[model samples]
Target: MASNLPAPEGVEIQEQPTAGAWGEWNPTEDSVRPVRGKHRVAKQRGGLARSSTVLGVGVIAAVGASGIATAQDRPQVTISLPSLPDLMTGGDSGHGGAGDNGRQTDGGSDAEAGTAVRTGVIPRQSDHRADAGEVLRNRILQQAESQQGAAEAQARAEAERTAREAAAQEAKDKVEAARKAAEAAAAEAAAKAEQEAKEAREAAEAKAEQERLAQQSGSYSLPTSAYTLTSHYGDSGSMWSSGHHTGLDFAAPTGTPAKAVAAGKITSAGWSGAYGYRIVLELEDGTEVWYCHLSSMSVTSGSVAPGETIGRVGATGNVTGPHLHLEVRKGGSTIDPLAWLESKGLNV
Candidate 1:
């Protein structure tokens, strides 16, 4: 209590800071402000134990989260051991009363960390590196397989499209060919039908002409029926009276009936020398028709109509077998009966 004197220069004075106007200091949200980013400071020596523990925990967390393979090939690094006793005692022996006051100034922490890392404390890096390489290889192979599958699918689709197009074209071609063939067949059938129709028309016209002629020449008839002409008019023959035949000879069996050529009148009857049994008829036009060679006579006088039975065919003229010698005369001169009959629309 006497006059207080100043202590030595190295000694610190314990002075209590005053809580101004507040009775007992109790901390509250408004009483303290947390240190901002820029104002924060790292403790130098006293906080060694806490800093080492925090660093060790952070390293372990990093190693667990990402395998060693995630790190690139690099130089080895030092790591610290978090055992507090060894670290605290080592720092106490090395630095004096500062360590007792929870401050250690010695640099032993870096050496201890290096020793801990060198002693092979963590998991082996070689095994992790191999696992990482295998995983990378598998990923590459998977990607390649996926690409190949996509390529194959594209190729199959292209092939299917090409096949579909080809099939469509083939079907189109087949349809076109069928249409052309049908058209050609139809045209051929039409031409054949037209030709057949034309032939039918010509035949019908010919028949009509024949019918008209038959109707126009009423009562006209052949001199006889079922007769063969052995000699023709103007035919040179040794059996004829004039060395050349003067009439159309109608050969037939004896007693075969002979008819009138047309409506006519009987001019003469009976035989005349080599002219045998003969008859003469004069037509309405004064054209004379002579029927020589007769086996018998049914009507030897008076007028007669066409196709009336007049006599029988016989070998009567200057002749051979039974036959009718037919002659046409105009102006008392002989004419060819065959030609005259054709002009009158007779087929014979």
Candidate 2:
């Protein structure tokens, strides 16, 4: 049997059996030939069919669980009907229906409902702080306006006070000035009264002195007989060199008797130069009397008598016609005869 077998060429043979404690001859290819489709179909039908049924059942169960979960996630709400009084009032009431149900019943769609829900979120506390800050700013501005008004009022009051004070001072000044003027007027009136009184006293004294002088001079008689004055002393005319007649001239008819003016001694009875026939008489108290332009002399020199005939009126040297020139002298100076005669109680 070994001689008739061929030589082993690409054949693989085990040298010894595995350590399973059993040694067995390898089976030939004819005994382990590849079976056709029937056996594989039988094997698959036994185990794979049962496993596919289990997997299908698990998938259906998962789909059912997902649908149940989706149903559970949908929004659910409960709504209680409002009370009759709340429904009639129409305004917001605590007993109103649930917010979601009210919105839906009031015709709010899903999108509007979502917007209203988002708007209902509570505002931050910081937003309230901002509002409060705005209110504080407005209050501060109002206070500033009030303060400004008060300041203006105070300024006006001050201005009025100043004006009043100025008016008061002006009135005071006017009163003071009036008082001073009144005092000045009174002083001027007093001074004027004093001056008038002084003038009156002086006038009275002068009158008294004049009366005493007249009383001391005794009475005298007329100087000429039936003679009229032709020229008075200090009379201006062309007959004299000095433009003034220094002696009184009396005009009478020729041979008119000239009497003594007073009780006096005959100082001279002669034909003087200018006075053709003249007589000079001296009284007791140094008074002198002159008789000029005489026609003739009745008494000689050194004769003394009262109311005695002294000379006769005549046209003599420098005489225009028959006239008597009578003159009176006191202490060798000529005096006004008319005034002297009047002082002696004679209206000559």
Candidate 3:
């Protein structure tokens, strides 16, 4: 700041400057450092820079708030900026002192103002800092809760899907198992039926073969052919010796064939007094069959099968006509010959 005051009465005025005088301002790192958050000024010259940063931010905020209020009421409006000199030199033409209210009178000199920038204007004030901080903290907590809820929902959905899949798999396995079980049961039933059928067929074939052998072997047969039953055992008759008949008589023509009733060996072949020219056939069960009044003997010895011809019918015994008198004896005792033959599956 160059002085325009006149030199005191030409006392060889010097161009050299004296003490406590301002110089041309060139900002340096020592005179001013960059302002960040808080309004701070260097001690080198009583903090002239403090007015710009804090005051500028406060003014911008106030203008912005007024603009919002004006737009709500009507439409957009512009605010003109102050002259650079007025802002820099901290002067308002309407006031007389530069101590306050962004005002200075008659361009007050630096010496009178005491600083290059006025420190009069105060920034907007807030009652407390915790209100803003608390709002931010609440927003953060709400965001965290929302994220956690979303994660829990996703986990529940995944669990439900997994459970459904597992249930479906279990049902499929049960169906497969049931199918296999049904197949096994069917196979077992078929095998059992087949085995039963096979056993039944074998039993039928065996029975048929047995019947065929019974026919071939002549298991039981009548004693003589072309005969009539003339006398029965236990008949009331006076035959001189016992007064009752002891044998059943089968009357036939002379020399008619007399056959063995069952398979046996010939035990006797000679005549007795009353049953003359008789033949005795002893069966395998030890029952003896007597063929009486035979005209001639054929199987007189050794073995003979059932229905084999062993003699011819005759009347050489007692007073009987041409007939076969058959008598059956068991355990050396006599049984009715007709009843014995009937018990052997023969109706004679």
Per-candidate RMSD, Å = 18.7, 29.1, 17.0
List the candidates ranked by lDDT, beginning with the highest.
1, 3, 2
Residue range 1-348, candidate 3, lDDT tens digits = 543544334111112133556443333343234332222211112333324333433433454555532112221121112222333434333443334444433324322222322333333324234565788899999999999999999999999999999999999999999999999999999999999999999999988766765663468889988889988988976773778788898989999999988888998899798788989899897989999888899978999988889999988868647889898998887788888776665767
After TM-score superposition, the amount by which residue 63's alpha carbon in candidate 3 deviates from its true location, in angstroms, is 44
Off by over 4 Å in 1: 1-212
lDDT of 1: 0.66
lDDT of 2 by residue, 5-43 (tens): 332453212122234553332223432232221110101
Give candidate 3's whole-model lDDT: 0.66
Q: Candidate 2 — what's its lDDT?
A: 0.60
Badly placed stretches (over 4 Å) of model 3 are: 1-169, 172-180, 183-191, 194-208, 211-215, 218-222, 227-255, 261-264, 270-278, 283-299, 302-308, 314-348
- Residue 314's lDDT within candidate 1 is 89
Collision count of model 1: 0
Error of 1 at 209 (Å): 7.5
Q: What's the distance in Å from true for residue 348, model 3?
A: 8.4
> Candidate 2: which stretches are off by over 4 Å?
1-123, 126-146, 149-153, 176-184, 187-226, 233-246, 253-266, 271-277, 282-288, 294-322, 328-348
Query: On residues 1-348, what C-alpha lDDT tens digit does candidate 1 reach at each position?
Result: 111334435322222134343132222343223222111011244343423323433433454455452111111222233222233333332333243454433345434433443343433346656786899999999999999988998998999999999999999999999999999999999999999899999889988767766863566888888988787888996777688888898888888888998898999999877879999989999999888878888888999999899999988657767899898899988888888988778888
Lowest lDDT sum, 10 consecutive residues, model 3, at: 70-79
Cα misplacement distance, residue 285 of candidate 3 (Å): 7.8
Compared to the true structure, candidate 2 yields what TM-score? Answer: 0.42
